[model samples]
Target: VPDITNVQVQINTGAPGYSPLETEQRITFPVETAMAGLPGLQQTRSLSRSGLSQVTVIFKDGTDIFFARQLINERLQVAKEQLPDGVEAVMGPVSTGLGEIFLWTV
Candidate 1:
């Protein structure tokens, strides 16, 4: 298990040149509702800007990264229809873990 971990989910409204404020208003409720009651989901923070929304899910220490991602994916799938047309949620890079970093001193 990694010492620290998080999963980032990005929601994008396919409508180009859309207003972030408007999009955020439409998505805020649905997205938050969708994220509720998910497993291993400790806390969530969200940001909305210019037709894009980002949510970061922080899990308790010792949670498996693979399971965390799977849980996120499943929840997002259920939330998809609730979002506006063309809106899509994507899971961020699984490889973002600090374990992927290498410190080498020569």
Candidate 2:
């Protein structure tokens, strides 16, 4: 496991083209709900809109998507029962182009 700081960012996707991204999403959260433990974390983004929710995942400098996906898949498999039904979660590429220019823009 690599060193990581716990960051949690809650984003509103419906806010005129809001896309999740690094640092912006890694703010802080409950221990179990964090992604630092998953490894190969280049970035993370969580989007909630119109009742739909999603997490955009990114890999680190030396990590590959396949490995990251596998780890995420296995964790989800184990957490299937723990998570509420109807909430579809999967590991997908984070769209940098969709990311915001800055962590915050007043």
For model 1, residues 11-103, the per-residue Cα lDDT tens digits are: 333435658786667665567678777776688877777767777677776678778778777877887888778667677666545544543
Report the lDDT of model 1 for residue 15: 34
Off by over 4 Å in 1: 1-15, 97-106
TM-scores for the candidates: 0.72, 0.49
Residue-wise C-alpha lDDT for candidate 2, range 1-106, written one tens digit per residue: 2334232222221222323332123221211254456776666665444344455555665575466667766655654454443433454343343244334552
**Pairs with steric clashes in candidate 1:** none
Worst 10 residues of 2 by lDDT: 22-31
